[model samples]
Target chain A: MFKKVLVANRGEIAVRIIRACRDLGLKTAAVFSEADRQSLHAALADEGVCLAGFKPADTYLNMDKILRAARETGAQAIHPGYGYLAENEKFAARCREEGFVFIGPSPENIRLAGNKLMAREMAAAAGVPVIPGSARGVVSRDEALAIAAETGYPVMIKASAGGGGRGMRICSGPEELKEEFSIARAEAAAAFGNDTLYIERYLQNPRHIEFQILGDSSGRVVHLGDRECSVQRRYQKLLEEAPSPALDGVLREKMGAAALKVAQSMNYFNAGTVEFILDEKKNFYFMEINSRIQVEHPVTEMVTGIDLVKEQIRLSAGECLDYDFSSVPGRGWAIECRINAEDPENSFLPSPGTVERYRPPGGFGVRLDTHVYQGYSIPPYYDSLLAKLIAWGPDRKSAISVMSRALREFVIEPVKTTIPLHRRMLADKSFADGDYDTGFVRKFIPVDEDED
Target chain B: MAESPKRLEIRAPIAGVFYRRPSPEDPPYVEVGDTVKKKQVLCLLETMKVFQKIKSPADGKVVEIVARNEDPVADGGLLMVLETD
Candidate 1:
């Protein structure tokens, strides 16, 4: 086992990794930006290094500074706790070249998974179900039109390098396709510096379900079952739950096997998620792969009782998975609500300020993962995620009830938060019944101006 | 008597740690009573390991320094006061 590891990220995820490292008897080194001088992650780690600046480019994203800090601290490995350089192939390669273990999948796997088109191709090659559309980039309007005709109407024109709903257009017909092709091309060029666009048949109201897979360097892999992340706003998941209410035992097994195949195909190691879009008719299609430990990983951890961060570090250290996959059936249902510092009533604008009053919920079956406390100043330089509240119960209904109660009991004052919206969502009949989709939040959450 | 020289406040454009020199070993970029030209690099703001040059927006004499070396500053935080000629 490594004696020390550097956490090359910040916020709650950094704290999560540091705690896991400590549990495994390893010292942790944390890097912080100028804005995060008093951050909880810095305080918790055995050693903390300040990157000196507040901007992301100068702090968390500065590879040289992070590597230098790791060297200075004599850290044997670097755990990029999602976002930032977690999925950055270059950073991973650099860590290895610098003789520091990169606690994730091989850089090659990250490169393949980072490209949407290549990942789709790999899925198809692996015999996994993928959305039918262009096999490659559509360079001309005629090519796009032909692809659209074959895939049927209501196709999505997506940038080859696009994400977060940028550089994309949905065309319902030939006229719309002709009009949108140039616009998408231009947008893709501006956003990603590449005009490459691809076409796909857009599935309506698809539930975003993903499987958490863990693999070791020896090629042994296991699936931690599925997480239903359909509760989203503009593709950003607000809530995630394990043992998806949409899947039965048979369907769950099938999806789990498919997820395993996806990981096996790439010889992927460490923790990664295989995301799929499940349609209304129960047909599932490969969406993309997130080649890092995700923000919503706690829900899976809650149900599986597996510490994913610890597993990532162990796998990187050449340890084989000790548990049998067939015996590790996920117990109970778990739900996670990402409490962000955003004012839902004001179009969800980020509200960064001091948390004058902070009272987190507690009880059996409830867990709070956060890096904030009373008087902790929320900096405007990074993500607005304040905390993650996860609740587990014997069943989905009990889990929902516990989560609703926990949300009500939680209090973060002065700066506005998404607690109100989460409270309203938990009370909605559709959400309570587990019959909500990605668009459910937008349609159901009332934008009451008076609430602000 | 000529109108009192217009006093201007030099504020940080971004939130970060303010540094008085390019590196710790270097002398301070400018001291009080030093005359500076427009766009001259006055100090450095370090964040995320990147050092950004904080320049003088106008020709001025450094009247007072509100922020000391290695001070954490927020956006628009006062760094110094300058008297324009």
Candidate 2:
């Protein structure tokens, strides 16, 4: 085991990693920006280094500064908690070059998984079921027409370099495809400077489920189970739960095997997520792989009794797979709500301010991972997530009940939060009955009436 | 000469890191006592990778630069004071 580990991040996740390091009897070095001098993570670590800049580009995202901090702290390993450089292959390679173990997947794995089309190709080559669509970019209208014909109606044309819904169009039939194909190409050319386009069969209201897999350097991989992250606002997950209400035992086994296959094909190690989109009939398709510990990892941990962070460290140190997951069906049900500092009533606008009073929920099966305090001024320089409140119980019903009760108990004064929204979700019959899909949040929350 | 000339303050339009130059290796846009044309680019305010160019609101001589290079300035924070014509 490494004696010391340097965490190159801030906020709740950095604090979370520091706690995990401390639990493993490892001294921790925390790096913070000038704006985060009083951050909880820095104070909790054995040593701290200031990156001397408030912006992410000069601080968390600056590889040289982070590497310098690791050297200064005499740390043997660097653990990127998430975001920033967590999935940056270049940073991972740099850490290895600097003689520090990067507690994540190899640079090669990160690079391969970072490219969406390449990842989809890799998964398909591994015999994992990817969404039925063109294997590569459609070169001409005739090729697109043929692919769409085979893929059936309602196909989505996406730009190779597109994001934020730009350069994307959905065609319902042959005529629509013909009309929109040229326009999509023109839009892609204008937007991304590349007119390369691909087509995919669009799945309607699919549930966003992902499997958490941990692997060792010796090519051994095991999946912990699934997390239903269907409740999203603008593609950002707001809530997640373990052992999805949508999956049965048979389907779970199949999806779990597929997830392991994807990892095994790439020889992927460390903590990673194999995301999938499940249609209404429980038919699953590969979405993409997240090459880092995700925000909702706590839900999986609650049921599996595994500390993913510790496991990542051990695996990075070249430890063999220890636990047997052959028959290890996870225990109980767990749900997590991301408590962001945003106003749900006002279109979820960010509400960063000092927490005048802070009172957290307690009791069994309730856990909060946060770095916030009563007087900690919420910085506008970073994300608005203040905390993650998780609840666990023997069954899904009890989990929901516990979450509702916990939500009521939690309070943060003056600063607006999504607590009321969660409460309303819990009270809604469709949500309580798990009769909602990825579009649930969009429909559940009524549009702001004052918007022009 | 008895009455002191009124100085106009140039405040930041948004909260971000203030940069005096377009890039790290480039020279600063303007310095104290440099005469600046109306609507001339003076500096930049960067937020989340988006660079917003701060232009001179009026033709003036740069009297004082309140914000240092690479400093984090809040929205409406003072950046410079100008002796306008």
Candidate 3:
């Protein structure tokens, strides 16, 4: 086992990894950019290395600098704590080649899951249900109609080479498809220079559900439970909770088994997340596999009583899966709200400045993971997430109450945060009742009238 | 007595980390007491990995570099002072 570990990231995640390493009696080293000299992670670590630049490319994302820091500090292991180079297979491979334990999945596992199409194919091959869609681009209207008929109506016809909502049309019946299918082809050719089009069944107002899975070098894998992250803005999750309100025990077991099957198919080890989209009918389709630790991992941890970062380190060191999943059963419910340094009223623009005053909520069932303190100057060079506030309770209702109370108590001054938005979301009837889907957050945000 | 030279300030165009050189290994684009042409790149301000080149507004001799290399700077933060005839 390695005695020292280097955290190859910054912000709250780096702080989290350092704490986990410390708990395991391992020496901790932190790498930081010049802008993050005063960041809590750097000061909290036993040793720190300055990466000599402020931007991510010159600092956090520079694999060479991270490797050099690990080598110089004599850190036997490197933990890429999400974001930055966490999912970069080449970086993981380099660390392994240099004899440093990378605290995550193997490079091969990352490669298998990194490609979205490949991940979906692997999931399908492993008997996991994927979203129903055409296997190839449609060459004729008849082919499109046939596939749409098989997949059901309300299918989305999209250009093979277009993105950003371009060259896309949704048809609810054969008449609409007959009228728009050819129009979409011409539009695709004019816009993307490709007339190729594909069709996929569109699930209106789907809920985002993901399973947390852990595995070891011995190929044993077990899923913890599910987290519902449907509360999102612009595809970025703002709040997440464990024991998805929409899932019962039977559905949970079925989806958990499916998650395990997907992991086993890739021979995945360490910590990974299997994301799925659940339609209104409760049918879940495999979306993709996230090979790195996710931003919303705390909810799973709180409910399972498992330290994921610690588990990752142990698994990377070739330890066997020691946690008994059946005994845990993901007790209680947990909720996490990401607090970002952005103004909710001002279109969520970044608000980077000195945090003149800071007060965080505390009490029973509350956990906060953060690196900011009073007088801390937030750098403008990175993501605006300032902290993650998580609350646990015996049930979903109690968890929501605890979170609302905690949000009311927390305070940060002179710099805008998403706290106000969280407060509003917690109070919304639909959110409190867990009767909302991915489209829930859009109602809160006013439409940009100036946009064409 | 000769009039004092006309001093003009060059401010950062964006909020980011200021750098005197294009890259760490390269020499600084301009130093104090160095003559520079108009539109010559004086420094770089990088945020989110996008670099915005801060260029000289006019031909002049740089009298003082206000912003240090590798330090975070705000938009409109002074970077250098140029003395022109």
Candidate 4:
């Protein structure tokens, strides 16, 4: 076990890694920006270092500063908890080069799976189900139009680099495609410095399903079931659940095997998520792979009873496959609602403010991994996510019931939240029957102020 | 009691601290009665250590600043309401 590990991320993930390390009798070093000086993650770590000012690039993304902090703190390993540089191949390579282990997939795996375009080709070659699209970048308007016709009218023009809806444009026709294509290309370049674009036949009302796969250093891989993350806004997931109410036993084994195949194909190690888009017909297509620990990982942990962070640490420390695919039988159902600081009344606009009152739910099967406190002001520079409320039960119905109860109990006054949306979703008939698609949020829960 | 819409609220794009002037010694961009344009830099929102400038979205006269200098601003927190023509 490493004497000390440096957390290369912030917020709840950082706090999560620190706690996991403490459980394993390993000391933790937290790296924070100037804005996070008083954050709980920093306070809880055995030692914390200020990497730079508040911006992500200067602080969390600064390779030099992170390495310096790691060296300064004598941390032998670096754990990146999703987002930021979690899936950055360059950072992972740098960590390996600098003699500090990165507690995620190797740079090679990230380079292959992290690139949306590259991953699509790889998955196709592996005979994994993939959404029919162009084989390469769509450079011209004519080429895009031709591909659109063949792929069908509602083709999506997406920037081949970033995924969080910034570089994505949904085109129902040619005119919309022309206007959306250029804008998506420009935004993609600005967001990821990549100007390449691609075309994919957009599945109408697709369900976002992902598989959690883990591997050891000695080339052993296993899949930990699947998560339904269809509930989303702006392409980012807001709610997630395990043992998808949509997919059955046969589909689970099929998707799980496909996910493991992709990881093994890319030589992926540690923890990674293989995201797939399941159409309303139960036909799942490979979307992209997140080469890091995901935000909704708690739901999976609840179902499998697997300590993923600890496993990542162990794998990085040259541990072999301790358990194969059937090590842990994930029973029951788990649900998680990401409580973000966004107003459900104002079209879900980001709501940053000081919390005058903070009371989280406490009971059976309810867990909240958060940093914000009553009086702790929500910083305006970071993601609006404040915490995650996860619940586990013997079945999906019980999980939903527990979640609805916990949400009604959890409170953060003054600033508005997406709690109202979650509340509505839990009670919605479509959600209860698992008949809704990704458009569930935008369709039923109108984000507009007037509708509210 | 709402006053004659003289408020120019410079909302933060992300969550962070609110910095008044470019530097402590430098003069602040707008005083209580300074006339400003749409692109006039009013204040800086310091988030995650990134200093994002909050510009005037409308041409107006700076009426009053609601948030205190160096205080934190939420996503929709009103910075300074300006009275526009």
Candidate 3 or 2, higher TM-score? 2
Candidate 4, residue A123: Cα displacement in angstroms equals 0.1
- TM per prediction: 0.84, 0.83, 0.80, 0.87
Better of 1 and 2 by TM-score: 1
Cα lDDT for residue B7, model 3?
90
lDDT of 4 by residue, A1-452 (tens): 67899998888888889999999999999998887888889999999998767667688888899999999999999998888888889999999999998999999888877578888888888889888889998898888989998989888888888665656778999999888877877777777889889999988778999999898877888888899999987677889999788898888889888998888888779898999989877899899988888999999899998888888998999887677557788788999999988776666666666789999897998989998777887766677788999998899899999999999998998888888788988998989998777888886555554331
Best by TM-score: 4
After superposition, the stretches of candidate 1 with alpha carbons farther than 4 Å from their true spots are: A446-452, B1-85
Predicted structure with the largest DockQ when compared to the true one: 4
TM-score of chain A of 2: 0.93
Per-residue lDDT tens digits for candidate 1, residues B4-46, read 7999999986566788987666799999999999988889875
Q: Which model, 1 or 3, shows the larger DockQ?
A: 3
Clashing pairs in model 2, backbone N/Cα/C closer than 3 A: none
Model 1 agreement with the true structure over A197-291: per-residue lDDT tens digits: 99999887789999998998889888888999999876789999998999998899888888888889988889999999999999899888889
Cα RMSD to native, each candidate?
A: 7.4, 5.7, 7.5, 5.0
Shift in Å, residue A348, candidate 3? 1.1
Per-residue lDDT, model 3, residue A413, is 88
* Worst-scoring 10-residue span by lDDT in model 3 chain A: A443-452
| DockQ for candidate 3 | 0.25
List model 3 lDDT by residue over A1-452, tens digit each: 89999999999999999999999999999999999999999999999999998778899999999999999999999999988998889999999999899999889988877655567678889999988988766899999999999999999887765532356688999999999999999888876667888887877879999999999999999888899999887567899999899998899899999999999989988999999999999999987788899999999999989999989998988889866568788889999999998777866666778889999999999999999999999888998899999999999999999999999999998888999999999999998888999999877766644231
